[model samples]
Target: MSVAAPPPSETTIADSAQNPSMNDLVTEQLVSSGDAASFAPRTALALLHYDVASTILTDLTPNELLNFALTCRSICNVVIPRYIWAHIALTPKHPRLQVITLLRKIAFSVECGPHFIRHLEVASIHVKKPYLKCRNPWYLPYLFQELFTQMQNLRSLSIIHCDKMLPHLPRIPKAIVSLPHLRSLHLANFSYLALNLLDKLSGLQTISLASPTYNVHEFLSSTTSALQKILVNSRHTLEEIRLFEVCLNVDLIPSHHGSRADADTNQELCWPHVHTLELPQCIGDGWAPALHIAFPSVRTFASPEQSHWWTAALRDASFLTGLESLHTKSSVARGFTMAGYTTRRLVIGDDMPFDVTNTPLKDLLPRHLVNLQVSLWSSYFDPTLERFTTVLPMVTPHLKYFFMRMNRGFICNTYHNQLCDIVDDIRTLPLEYLCITWDVNCGKKRCDRCVRRSCPEPVAKYVERRLPSLQALTIRVDENRRWHWKKKKVEEDGVPAGTLSLMSPTREGDILREEYAKRIV
Candidate 1:
């Protein structure tokens, strides 16, 4: 006690030499007998009995689940569930023959038979190289029919990019028409087959057709009566229709007396339950006045292309007046006044010109907008950021979420002070969520000030000081150094107010840039 007992380390070693403890005896027994029970209880098996663990296993991908099942015997028993093999995708890049063989094996497996495939996608079909080759080119059709007939529970089907199958239009498989539970269908670049398929499926709730090679105007004219019958049959169940890079003629719609009469007397065909309509920008001007008449209940309208037709449609007094969400290019939105429009969410593309005068943000944006997403394609300069700041006060009162995505080479030369200033300006607004994403350039000649690791410090401090109402803030510097700032209202102090994590870099270039903003919170 007087000399601290020669320190605990030295005393412990001396005491151990005199008398070994229970731990030492157990180690000796384990080494001599090679028995696992001498150390600890078999608690790993207990994890399989937990509900939380089962929920986690359900979230794993198909390949990951397979790997986890093979890790040990106990996990394999818990991992083999029918829901894990419900969705199957077969693409062109991989060997289709091998994939089909595997699918056939899974379909007839004694343990998990038949009803395994609920959603099936045959994507990237290159007409040049059919999935199955033989002396008879029509063999693939029969094979597809057989596969579809076997999967009785198939509910969703997608066939895309089959341009080379135009010559085999009539020979396309018809098994899809007989699916009792098929609720959704997506077809692209297969005009004849798509029309034929639509004529057969009367219970579909969702239909998406894109860039059909057939002349839409001529086809509609020739099959106006059949199209009317299909529309009438699906009026009760159809809820969404997406048309991309194609124009629909309004005159072809069946009307009272089978003729176009005065607006007061003419009764247009209407889908009472349909609320979502996605139209291409190339839709004709004659279709503008008939939009609301045809879809009186439409609430969400999207223009997926960059064309002036959507702007023209918005100008019509008879166009859809109850739209709650709109997706359009910034260029098309210029010179349009959405003051009377009730749209609450707006998504603007990045292809707008840099000049703010051409596409005035404050004038074009609706006052009721609660969520705003803007894309910036400016590779070398970010002129839109400064212009957007000028209009923040106008949208500050109602806006709740703001998301901005910038393309490559956009933030390589930006300094910490610029980010701090932007955050300071944003703090004046009452935003609940904010997300900013840009590609980080790590080239050799990059600016030293820009590459400094403490770039996000000032921005984080500003949010902590100026924006007390902020709930969540996320900033990504490419695939690495993603900074997240979240407020925990229940905690008082000592806990970190924000967190910055460094993650491994992901895929490169345009594709990665598009996906960077979509990472989980």
Candidate 2:
């Protein structure tokens, strides 16, 4: 007749749920007490089979693991290795100083170790508005060199730089190369000094050399030949390459498209495994032919922001012909339709190169598109509204995720009703996630569109009823406000319909724009 251990307290169970370190403590207590109780079929014994337990634990999300424990009366718990906390973590927000602090903690903290951090993004280094009350500006470079040295298990890394951070990047490169497991590397505002270091990295699957938001260092041109040289190290393993605007300030050669390079200046070097390629200014100055020859199997291609280049490229654009996904301005899509290119996923970012009234909007869309994101300036496209709406059902009948961004031009009457009609017309499709907004403020004189407006409760109920397969619907009538409906959340008690949802933003501002870029890539 051995005495039994008391059931674990609520505080202990909750702590174990959030803290992976506490998981072992909870399990050990239960085991010493000599009772399985409800504590998940003696998980400690299962942990003895290290490889099997590690594989199972790695696959389950914290929420999924918690749910599995609930089925066992929520009293018992699973043992998640404390070190895994580094991998399942929140990347601290932009302004890299905050990320530096998080790195300092994980680099030395007793519970969470550096080895678990497989991916790390030193998010931002905003020079204009530095948040320094005490720390010197030089602190960023020092922090990266120190903390990154400890994170040897790192599989992916990104360093996002602003105007001032470029000076500090020299010392940071050595620390980055220390990680043997590095697979992906993204360096925003990349300069030429780091060229030799990338060659040291092996087995890299993706490399992004992004341009700074402002063209501050326009003098140091990263030419097309340099781009080919960079890929020579990891061309076989690289699956994605984004050298957006890296060719900025290149010596321009005049052509039909301004700044278009007419000749193939660089030799073609193919990276057949790279299925995704993003070239903005890179296509200018004759980089297109070599790129076209190099990434022949690219399933996705983000055409240049210049519709003229996209239009010019379409003539010999064999790359565009085979793309499974396409991202460009509205005018580029019209050119795509004109050029006879098709893709399953289409993202038209609404940055028009010319007046959009010439082509029919519905005709521009590929009829078989499974996902579509389009941003439209309301006044620009108001002329074709009626005709486009009538044929949308026949066009995108297979759409699943549809995101529409509409900016209300000061002179133009609101297209709210017609926009909703576009949503209503596509009801028969199996559209799962739908977002419609009248919320883009382009920093010009304010429009009546920015004034606070909300749909009557009836409008939300109407769309929810019509789109039966729709799991999430987000509609923003006001710039700072929105309404969200999720199938599960809507059904819960105390969850009101048409509530003031937080940050259901369209892809407009700096933060959302970063997200927008990621979605297309």
How well does candidate 1 match the true structure in TM-score terms?
A: 0.66
Q: Which residue pairs in model 2 clash with each other? A: 39-76, 261-286
Off by over 4 Å in 1: 1-56, 66-86, 91-130, 133-147, 162-173, 217-221, 224-232, 250-259, 262-268, 304-320, 331-339, 353-360, 377-386, 407-415, 439-466, 476-521
Q: Please give, for residues 1-521, the per-residue lDDT of candidate 1 as tens digits.
A: 00011112322211212212223333433454465452233225324333444556555654444333322223333333322343344333446344443333233221222222222322111122334443454545555444545655556767775544423544444555666777776767755544555565578788776666666556655655333445556767879877776555432243222235555433436666787778654454434345666677777777646463555566554444676766777654443344355567677764443234445566667766677777654434444444555556565457767776655434445644555555666666667667777565655554564543544656665655766666666666665656665565453355553432221232222333334333222
Cα-based lDDT for every prediction:
0.51, 0.52
Determine which window of 10 residues in candidate 1 has minimal summed lDDT.
1-10
Which regions of candidate 2 fall more than 4 Å away from where they truly are?
A: 1-144, 162-171, 194-199, 212-228, 248-268, 281-283, 290-292, 310-312, 315-318, 351-358, 379-387, 409-420, 428-430, 440-457, 478-480, 488-521
Per-prediction TM-score to the true structure, in the order listed: 0.66, 0.61
lDDT digits (tens) for residues 1-521 of candidate 2: 01112222433333333325535544543464355565555334342333343345455553344333323222223322222232323233455545443433333232333222222422211122222222555454555445445555667666555223434455445655566667787777544444444446557788777773443234335433333455656778889888767543231212332223433432224566889877655545433343455666798877667665554477656667788888787767877876677788888866432233355556688877877877655444443445443555677777777776665533223345555566676777887777776653334365545334433345566677777777666666555666665555442355554442223233333243334333421
The per-residue C-alpha lDDT of model 1 at residue 436 equals 72
lDDT score, residue 468, model 1? 67
| Top-lDDT structure, candidate number | 2
